[model samples]
Target: MKNDSGAVAAVKARANIAEIVGRYVTLRPVGSRLVGPCPFHQETKGSFNVHPDKGFFHCFGCQASGDVIDFFCRINGLEFREGLERLAAEVGVDLGRARSDPRAAAKKRERDACLAMHELADRYFRHLLGRDEGRVAREYLERRGVSAEMIERFSLGVSPEGWQGLQTVLRGRGFDDDSAIIAGLLTQGKNGRTWDRFRGRLMFPIRDGGGRVIAFGGRVMGEGDPKYLNSAETPIYTKGQHLYGLYEARPVMAKTRRALLSEGYLDVITLHQFGYGEACGVLGTAMTHEQAKRLSGFAPRVDLVFDGDAPGRKAALRAAQMLLTLGGACRVVPLPDGEDVDSLLHAQGRDGFEACLERAEDGLNFCLRMVRESYAPREIVAWAGEFLGGLADEGLRALFIPRVASGLGLAEAELRRLLSRPAKRPAPGPRPGETAAPRQPAWELAPRDAQILSFVVRRPDYAAHLAGAGAGELLGNADARLFFARLAGLVSDEAEARLTEPETAFWAKAQMEPPVSDEDAAAFFEELCVFLHEARESDRRRSVMDAIRLAQQRGDSEEALRLLGELQALSGRGDE
Candidate 1:
């Protein structure tokens, strides 16, 4: 199936590849391509090459090669569809109208409407914050050491006390109750009347990586039952999919390749104000795999700053486990018994916070300490098994298994065997915590097959030459055969969607190699085809010999002679 061709093509056509990539990497023109140090990884030689004419980039250092959309997605931690939508908006392309499918178009329209409603609501909240009604919230922010600059930077606002305050504003702006409610800006009561969802609270606009307001998180200015109120899941926002200040933190994160993962909006803002610009907060929820993955794009190292209380330590431990399992380096910044990032920063300033960071411990070491403290010696094995079982990558699991085994005084093999069994429900009672692991390729191909597949993936134009070459038949690995079969008639771009995750990774990596000339590709293709043909014949001869031996073992003279003659004919044809 084709992608949203009209929308994708329009966005790509309007996008200047060099200009877009230059925002992240400093580039200088080199022949037809622009060259720069790769933003995806550290390199001093400027191996990242961007071809303006082709509208694609390739990093010789990291093997990252993709079009403008791919670059935007990779750099910003966005999915393909989300990246496309953001780019489409940038290019002034109405994706809904560009789509041919009526149903899909309608859905896109609803999504767009929700986003517009959110923007409108954000403005309304900001307007309320500057007015007389916002006096109480403004005073509260000032008391908490929040500056006017930060208020503007984070788009901090106040929702008026009146239930209909925001409802009226939205209605006046031409937003219906249904649309406002769907955008998580308003709520419907039991009496069937709609009202502002966030009232008498300080508003923090939560944005996506593109800096568009997608949702809001509200904090009570004074005493309240539920201290914090966040926007419910809507068309444009999911609770665990975004970090509060990521949009603002991205620039610093890109430079440092590190992030400060905090647990509150004020914490993130405070960190930034204190020169820790590479800081963001979870949206009032536990850290998630999606959020971890998003952070991994900008920062390879994450410093988790949580409260010093028991619950905060527990949270830090959990977050660190997730970061480690996701192949991210993490450190836990420990605070005093009653301190948090915001409180500590306000009390002691940047110097004090830096001291805490200096005292941060490695993630795995913290995990081991927590587990040892929380669990008894008898329970260590069970805990180790559960943690190791949660890890999907056997190699990563193996690396950790030794350390865990050493900590628990158990054999590494014993822990491996425990993980090998089917996962069981956690034993009854309170547990220390849970952790997750990263993923790796599940299968590998023979060297010869891999070389052939890599060539075809990069030079898809030559796939036609393999039409009658029996290359697929000679592939011993099932993954290689399947990839070859599906990729035979597809273009390089189209092949990505059809491939498995591992296959797509292989395909992308192969594209990083130096482009082969047509003559070189032809010669390589010819040599591989000959090898496959010879291998195929050798297999046929081996099978015939096996059959002849089987017949002879059965003491059937006539059958053995017949098989021998067939084998001789097969060998004769191969020799010819």
Candidate 2:
């Protein structure tokens, strides 16, 4: 881990933050900093600021701030390690010694190999789609109105009817049977013979947030038992962790801050073809919390474009509940019965699709309507209780409670009481190998504390003076105290690496703030010292008053009188 940290610091030191950020945001010089519209959210004004000298970016509008690694991770939907590796590669840094542990190094190599195999498999599938053997699959796609451009964009491919087609390709490419099987490109039979996992089907390559091919989903082109077959859980890809078409849709979604979430692969492709570039699909599984969170990172609002049948409606309801609980805005776009995004777009084109979107209903309202229509009164209450219980935010829960109550024909008070009852716990505790979530540090600071910290951050020379005045004791927030303690001795640039997750945004924003003048900083420091002294005295006075009341209540008159005398002496000193 020490070596890893060293590697991370080396990468950060070498990588140009502005150059990386400029890829996503068109930045213009603003004094010493660069300014651009925030890629994290939709904004007209250039509130996102990049400090090339400091190697960090901050958005005043959304308060999104971090270093280059943070920017890449957030924008690409990657984890810290993945982002570090990717950036390290880009910056031409060697991480070989950083991953010195043989076991960890081996694991990394295995994941890399799996990813490489998937890429090869993707290329093979695409090649086959252009070959003469792919005539059937190509015809099916043509009839479905899938254009050549879309086919290329999505890397659409086909597996021939024979089992050894992909197997032969992988073997020739030097991928062994075990590795190919692990990558989900080949399956072994009971007779101990390995064959292609996706035969006679249209293949959709699944990629990670960084656009690395990791897995595939294959839909049968002709009559078959299972219409769709997806890659099993692989080292590089999980079932529900990644969404289809997200890599293609990310840029548009970032600009729009909205996404059209549908069910099937064709639905997503069709949506993208029809100019809804901010469209993605779930990977053949029910919407998970991880997927919802990933989508919310790029787009605050998601429009559910699932099929208009009963099962699709049910899926939409579940997805809407999850998104609402996560504090994401969403709408349910209703297509005609038996119509999906693909069928609707093809039959009536963009105008029809736009009309359906125009009729989209709020996610919560959709949930309520569905509950009211499908569930009986008792069931509706249970459903509402379950839904409300899942909401961790009390304010958000309160806002939705009234609507749920009204829709269910129950009094708000009754609904509240029902929710108040002890409900079944979803999980008894953290599962094996999973630790309980850490308690978050209080990130908010009181106004005075914020002012004090802000001044100290801008003018680090005054930190010693503020500390000498017992400013740390007067600070209310734990995060503020920790931040001051950690960064008081270091320069602002040095403080960036020391920040905790809770402190990163604040630190970045403080760095981007206008620098304080020497005179202004001195005056503010003195004023802050005096304020802290007065605040400390006030607190002491209040404590003594409380003691005096307790003494009087206990009939300890002498003690009470003595305390009063001390209080009088203090007041006289203040007056002097």
Candidate 3:
């Protein structure tokens, strides 16, 4: 059934917040609100409070507060839509087979048609895997250490080279050729020809949280340039949004509150087969923001298991950025230079894999180390500042300040001064009957940055005033920088554009403030420009100091003195 606001309200109304929370945590009666140890973060005392009457939860330990739907989404690693569907199923409320709206209903019909095609195609692929031509695919899997039980559990299939293998099966099931193509099972070739998309390959069905097969990933059994192929974006499937083995892994992750992230489909299957049931992998695409958010919902933490090689380390860094950007907890499991999860498990067994995980570095520390390795010594602080600025928690950032400075070979006091500037506070919640609240940033934007963006968003031409003002450099907060950039992009076609979730709420808050008169705008803009100039000058002084330190390290007294002179002049305090 397609969901609507009414169906959501009905499901939430019927569902007991306490009962749902009780499933994951041990709660005790604490007056009106129930208290428990927060599942999202570690706590020695019960700081997680749930208000059943208000239908909301707030964790004092982590400051995490949300409604029932948020709880489901965070705990199960499901998207908003998937979470609603799950809660609806739990509460026994039907959202209707199609939404009440006609346009949505039409889209739902198309999605349903695609879903039916995938279901039929799954059977066809599985049936074909049992045939003579499928022997090679089966043998290849067997050699790769996949068991018959796992093969059945994962619903492994084979797509033969014969162009019409899948096409024939879909047509037999009364599914039209158009439906098959739309479902991503069949491809339209040059000259209006139709053929199977995955041919002579081992097929792995990618399922949603409900175990509904939505897409397929195929790996060639024989020689091919692209070793692995996945379904294109379809009416029902977005590759980056669905992970291989997620459906199987979610249950275990929910219980354990941890998940192992691997590089490929087989790595997830192998890990799960070897007693690591909480393992999942991204589809063929690079890790995405949606994937990171969804994974964070399934488990509070994810251990990224990549090949211990240059490319693997690089991939881990990219992944860490995404997770950290969203304030998701993660660890980077460093393998031997040539090893991956599957190969390591195959060679060293479960004990070896466990040892590797034990040595996993916290995602932040790993990211910091990566930055130190990649950037020049003089530029380390700037990069570190940028990375640390992405952190959502002010307390967490404070704790890391010393380490970041140490990593950059700077004093703690100097680093603290450099990073201690505060950002704007969160806007108040929406009033009754207002639109849904926007997603809040992990860290607030600086007030000046917020004001500048507010004005620029409403008056697009104002962005021109930021040129040569060091506006970008002065923005120490990542969220502010992102909002500023988004605001700039919105200048053209302002009517059709929609602000990002966080930006939407942020803009709403901005609109609530008294309007900026033309006189205030000019003065405010000039003040911001002055602040930007001073901020950029301070940054330059720090760069000079860094250069001086580097010069001294290399025993270059002359160069060190010259850089020190530059720093003194920039600071407007001549060397004493």
Candidate 4:
């Protein structure tokens, strides 16, 4: 969906294309026009070109080009309001009353409600944890060797053991149990009562890259069927959509170009304590293709580490499949039989942990080995073999096939047979109108438009030229002449003799490239007559001085000195 009308309207308001592109991209003068790479698509070539005289964009690589607002929206992934905000920032124009978008606005309001609920709950939990009654949860974590700094870094909180403790607090804050249930912070009981969803536990808040608290994960100190509890999904938070600790890990991963994916929140923290702060984990689900793609945007590679158990093996295999599908590098670390990522780090420290990483298998290879170990029958193994083979690209298959054969101790010919098999369905074709024509200047120029060209190229001198020449004959174009006269009149008489300011204070809304019409030409001529009068006055003063100087040199003292004093006053060179 494109806002074609908005683009057309903004384009019409602009006199030149450079002004349009300047909203999104910086432009530098090249020959007669400004040039910069198009922001419409990801291309480095200055194929997206603009002509200052014509307000439009032409992209050579992918023809999806438009005007200023379109450029802002497409580049920044913003809506009309957001684009207006950016334009306001650029030229300091305040966007007026916003038009109706009730549906989007409602969704934003709901998300804001969810956000506020999360904040209130987080603060309450933190307050509970810091109190004397939270001693049990605090000591339990301390006994487990979790440092105070680590607890604070994770925003660890405690939930009271009483069923109605948190529910009472929320209810007093004007939210009934139903409201808390809707916010995913509480669960209603079958006996017409409500209680805290998390009780007698330490809480860990899960957030996105923007650090907005989307959900919470709580761990119980005592034995239970499910040792950990989490907030249910709400409008702004989705469990499968967000990975735990990703918010904190993102910046580090972006800087390092590597991320470590672990099994639990504690594993993530332990790795950080052991000096791998770019470590993160999935919350109660197998890693999905969506999570893999998001992680890849920050880090070039992800170490898909899981527990050394059957369930962990399955999770690692799923992570590998997603990574292979998305085409990024993955390394798999197999911990000791009884150890998870957390224990391994705590027991071995950074040196021992890194040693394990160094020996880790490539994720795809680890998945292949796991598949070999879990063979159901020859039928199932063959299908697994085929699926694994299909994951490789042509180039990767060439490099990986020999390695896979050697790792499995199978013949290369046999592996080749599985790889050669093709799928029934094919990928989609290129998007329609995806190819952009090579960009050319959108506006045309004359070979003899040097005077118009000089206005932009030589602003100081040429502006002064316009100032000296008065109006109509000063600049070539009627529009330029009219604007220059108005701009020149802005300069005071004191500024005239020194060529300092063209006095264009009144030229604020004055379109430099005004519309050339009969009226404009007439106005130019009117300004020209007044400018010529001043030019003649200047000429007469110079002539009188020359005659006086010649006469003085020949002993005509009266005429020489009289002419010199008159010249100073007429030129505004003397103090008035």
Q: Best candidate, TM-score-wise?
A: 1
2 versus 3: better lDDT goes to: 2
Candidates sorted by TM-score, best first: 1, 2, 3, 4
TM-score to native of every candidate shown: 0.75, 0.74, 0.66, 0.58
Backbone steric clashes in candidate 4, count: 5
Candidate 4 weakest lDDT stretch, 10 residues: 497-506
User: How well is each residue in 345-378 modelled by candidate 1, as lDDT tens digits?
Assistant: 9999999999999999998888888888887877
- The CA lDDT at 333 in model 3 is 95
Please identify model 2 stretches exceeding 4 Å from their true place.
1-6, 22-50, 58-65, 96-98, 392-395, 417-500, 503-576
List the candidate 3 regions with Cα displacement exceeding 4 Å: 1-10, 13-100, 324-329, 377-382, 410-576
Runs in model 1 lying further than 4 Å from the true structure: 1-10, 13-65, 74-79, 91-96, 389-399, 409-413, 416-503, 513-576
Model 4, 329-432: lDDT tens per residue?
A: 88898788889888887787877788889889988788678766776557343644554454535666676667667665667787677555546323222223
2 versus 3: better TM-score goes to:
2
Candidate ranking under lDDT, highest first, comes to 2, 1, 3, 4
lDDT, candidate 3, 1-576, per-residue tens? 011146655877888989988876778998878997676664446888887975767775566665677677666555566567768887898877754456755765788789888888788789878889789988998889998888998999998889997788788888888878888888897778999898888999989766888898899987895799988889888656777888888668757878899889899889988999999997756677667767775577789998877778877887886687556678999787677888888889999988988999999789778877887866676666666676677876776778777866778887766667634322223223234335655757776667667776555456656634656556658667756655555223222222344565455444435667788778877888778778778778888888988999999999998888888888887857
Maximum-lDDT candidate:
2
lDDT of 2 by residue, 1-576 (tens): 011155667988899999999876778998989998776654467889998987788888667787888888887766566677889998998966545456756767788889888888888889988899889889999999999999999999988899798888888988899988887888998898899998999999988877889888899987896889988887787776789999999889867878999999999998989899999999767787767767876677899998888889898998898888777789999899878889999999999999998999999999989998899877887788778887877878989998888877889998888777755423223333224556775568888777777776677677777777888887786667867775564223222335666567766767767888888887887787788878877887888889999999999999998888777765666343
